[model samples]
Structures are given as C-alpha cells and as structure tokens.
Target: MSGGRSAQAAIAIILAGGRGSRLGGRDKAAITLGGERLVDRAVSAARDGGALAVIVAGPAAAVPPGCIGVREEPAYGGPLAALAAALERPEAATATETLLLSCDLVDPAAVVGRLSGARWPAGADALVLRDPDGREQWLAGRYRLAPLREGVTALGAVSGLPIRQALSGLRIAWLDTAADDVADIDTPEDLDRARARSELGAD
Candidate 1:
C-alpha cells in the first residue's frame, strides 16, 4: 500500500473493441488527440497510475509499445465480452485488482490514480468514477480481480452481453468527479473538443 492505500497490485485492461460507428467506422482507439493515439494515451495513463501491466482489448496491431493486446471471440463483441477475455489472461490471473477503462477517456491516468488511491469500503467489490451528473462511468473503474473473475464466471457465455447486465449485482463505490475527467470521445466534435483540451494541457 502507498500511504495507507490498498496494497493490491493493479493490471489495466483498456477496452478498445468498439465498432466506432459514430466515428464513421474508423478505429477510434487509433484516433489522435494532440498527436497521440487514444490507445497510446490510455496506456501511458495506466502506467502513470502505477499499473503493473497494461493490456489493450482490441486489435493487437494497433496497441502501443509495452502493452499486450487481445481480442474477444467473434469480433465486435461488446465491452463485456472484451472484459471477460481480459480477465482470462495470465496477467489478470496474477493481479490483485483490475483497472478497467475505455479507449476514449480524456484523463484516464487521473481516474486510475484516484480510484486506486481510494480506500474502498469494507467488502466493496469495485470503485467506479461518476460524472458531475451522477452518471457512473462503468468502464472507468478499479475492480477487485477475484470478485470480477467470480462475477464473470457466474454469468456463463458472456459474449456480446451488455456490461449493465453482466455486472449488475456487484457492490460498487462511486466517486463523483468533474465531467471532463470522465468524458469520452464518441463523435467528431467530441474528438475536436478533446484535441483542444489536450492542447491546453488539461487533464
């Protein structure tokens, strides 16, 4: 533990399997913000957050250096499927916690650091970040790996399952943060905003 924080070592698994239909079917993970691909930024943030390892759940070829990449079965499977696949990997098996993130976060490292540094309530299974509007950013959370694995195992054949369905019963602790911290790039205009924010050196 760092300064009374949880001692669990974290493995970051970034979900990058989205079809990006809103971005004209382009690979959103490869989209650039301030000259850096979204995937690359996510990887760097995870590292900065003290992740023991980083994995990208999507096209292997597109992932940044120093990160492993895996894909869910039946390409285009939803985030839950990608998460399930990530949990099965050897790195995750050895990890005490998992930092789950989507590729489009503008400040993933900050979210990861905040969640990792928090002292979760006794028996809490996860720590999820929430926007100012009180909307949970499910993908931007830190989960106890054992509970996560058990949850996934309890729901058999999770391929294509919606995240809300797959993770419904877990005990989640929510931390309310600025909307910008949890904002994601979905459309081109969102990308533009993120780029502008990046140029401003905003987290």
Candidate 2:
C-alpha cells in the first residue's frame, strides 16, 4: 500500500463474501463477465479509478485473484458489521476512503466511473450510488471512513447503521447509473438473463 502520493485516491474494498442464494448459490464475485472474473473486473476498474490499495471482503470458500482478502469480523453479521470487520484489516489502516462492492454487478467499471465523477462535498459522510432502477445499492458506492466508523460505533452493530444515518450529520452525493449497471446476479433467471444479454451485447 502506498500513501502520501498524489496518485493515491482512496482505499477500495470489495464486499464479496455474501452467500449468494441467487445465481444457484454461486459466489458472485467469482462470476465471469466478458471472460474475466467479476472481482477482477472490480479490481481493475478501481485501480484505474485511482485506488491505492484494493481489498476483497468475502468468505473463505474461494477468493478472486489480485486483492487482499478480508472477512466479516463478526463472522455472519450484516454489511455494517462486515465493514467494521473489514476496516480492521491490516491493510485497511492506510485507506483514506473505502468502497463497498456489490460483487455481482454487470458493469463494475461503469459503477466506478459513476463514483469517481461524483462531488463528495464537505461534511459528506458517505455516498451511495442510486441505481436509476430504484434499488439503493450499498455496493458501488463511496464512503468517508472516519464518519462511518463513528456512526457504526455509535449505532452499535454495523448492520444497524444505515448509510442514510451515517450521512445524517453530513452531506451525501448520489451517482445515478443505469439499471443494468447495478443489476445483481441473483437467481438462475438473472444469470440466464445476464448470459442472454451478453450474447445480445446488451448492457
């Protein structure tokens, strides 16, 4: 991990350990898109977007290549708890900002692009991308680490703290993206649709 460099934009982390009951219980980050692993897509996009360090937060089952592995600290708790755990990652100490990955998006690079061009205002606690389709996706977002830690601690469990709540005392930026961009790989139907779309060159 490098710090004090003008090029170091933020510390990026991918939340990949979700037990994907969708997509036939397959690991979403490991899912392939355009012949490249989804997690790899995320890493590449994040690095290209200026991440100084990249971390993968997920289960021990199978991890994608080219990232520092991170698991939820509370083991099986929700995202907030999982992030708190990830924040404690040895490599996380140098991260100025942290990114939460949905692990199953069709366009990770687009997601990163949406976030990179956003205006993270002063007092802006965190920024969550609004998937124009209406889902408030936690992944594909930018976070101000310091305030997140405070809110998570004050709110008790990490899962208990909502992104809104953390930004309650601060400003938040929303980067709108296409529905297909944030569409997750959940269920065989979704997977099939993804494959079908891939064949059709849609998305």
Candidate 3:
C-alpha cells in the first residue's frame, strides 16, 4: 500500500469483539456480506487506505494473516476496551493518528478512503462521521493517537466503559455523508440489507 500524509502516519484499529447477540450469537467478524468476511474487508480497507499498521482487536481466530490480533483484557469488554487494548500495542506507539473501525461495516474501504482523503482541520483531535440520522459513528472515525491514548489512560479501567465517556473531551470535526456507507451488520435483517446493497454495487 502506498502511503500519504494522513494514512502513512495512521494505525488502523479494527474492533471485532462484539458478542453479536442480535445475530444469533454469530461472529460478526466471520460473517459474510456478498461473499467476503467482514474482518477481511476491514483489513483490506486498512491496507488499501495506506495505514502504516493494522491491528485487529478480537479473537485470534478472527484475525487475518499480516495483521496483529489482540483481545481486550476482559473478552467482549466493548468497543472502548477493544480500542484501549489496541492503543497499548507497540505498533500504535509510532502512529500520529488512528483509523478506528468496526469489523461489521458493510463498506469499510469506502469509509476509510473518505476519512483518509478528507482535509483534517487544525487543532481537532478527531474526525468522525455522522450518519443520515445525525448520530455520530464513533467507531468510523479517525483520531489523534496522543489524545486517544491520553483518554484511555484517564479512564483507568476501560472494560465496560461507554465509548462516549471514554472519548468525552476530544475536539471533533464531523463529516456528514448522505449515503449508508457506514452501515454495519448487527442483525439478520441488517445482514440482508448489506447483501442487497453489495449486490447492487452500492458500496
């Protein structure tokens, strides 16, 4: 992968430790939408986006080759804990920023491109996407590594910590996208929608 200013200094951290209770206990990382496993798609997106390193915060079984796999201290400790675990890795130490993503995203590559190519504002600690309903998709954001590490440190115990609380003090820059590029699989119905979108070449 060729590196650029934004992507070259970044580390992609993929959160894949969800319990998937709504998907009949299926592993979201292994789930396929349009014949591609979600975790594999995430890794491809990170590499294609030119991230210096890729880290999958999930079970070893879900981690693909050429990527680092790490588990949160308490398995299934939620996204914040997964992110905290990723930040502790040696790979993250040299990165200036982080591409925080979830393994369930239907179009991870598109989202990664959007974030990596966008003009990050000066003094902002993060650049996050806002879905159609105006809800912030925290996991679909790019964050300054220093601030993220500081935030995790301040939280002390990251397990079970709410994501919003964990990143409470960061200055954010929001990107509003009209498409469902940030849609993620959480249920059978969601999976069906993602498949339909994929087949339609919407992604």
> In each prediction, how many residue pairs overlap at the backbone (N, C-alpha, C within less than 3 A)?
0, 4, 0
Model 1 Cα lDDT, one tens digit per residue, 1-203: 23234445778999998999998998989888878888888888888777878889998766788788889988888898898888888999988887899999977777777876788788888889989888888899888888888888888888778886756578998888888889899998888888888988955
Which segments of candidate 1 are over 4 A away from where they belong? 1-8
Per-residue lDDT tens digits of candidate 3, residues 111-174? 9878888776888888898888988889898888899889888989978988988676899999
Model 2: residue 154 alpha-carbon error in angstroms:
2.3
Give candidate 3's total backbone clashes. Answer: 0
- The model with the greatest TM-score is 3
lDDT of 1 at 111: 77
The root-mean-square deviation over C-alpha atoms between each candidate and the true structure, in angstroms, is 2.0, 3.6, 2.0
lDDT of 1 at 56: 92
Q: For model 3, state the Cα shift of residue 39 in Å.
A: 0.6
Cα lDDT listed for each candidate: 0.83, 0.69, 0.87
Per-residue accuracy of model 2 over 1-203 as CA lDDT, tens digit each: 12222335477877776667655667777788778777787888888778777777777543555667777656545556667777787666665677667667777777777777676665666677777666677777777777766765676656545544544554566666778877767787887787787778845
Question: Cα RMSD for candidate 1?
Answer: 2.0
- TM-score result, candidate 3: 0.94
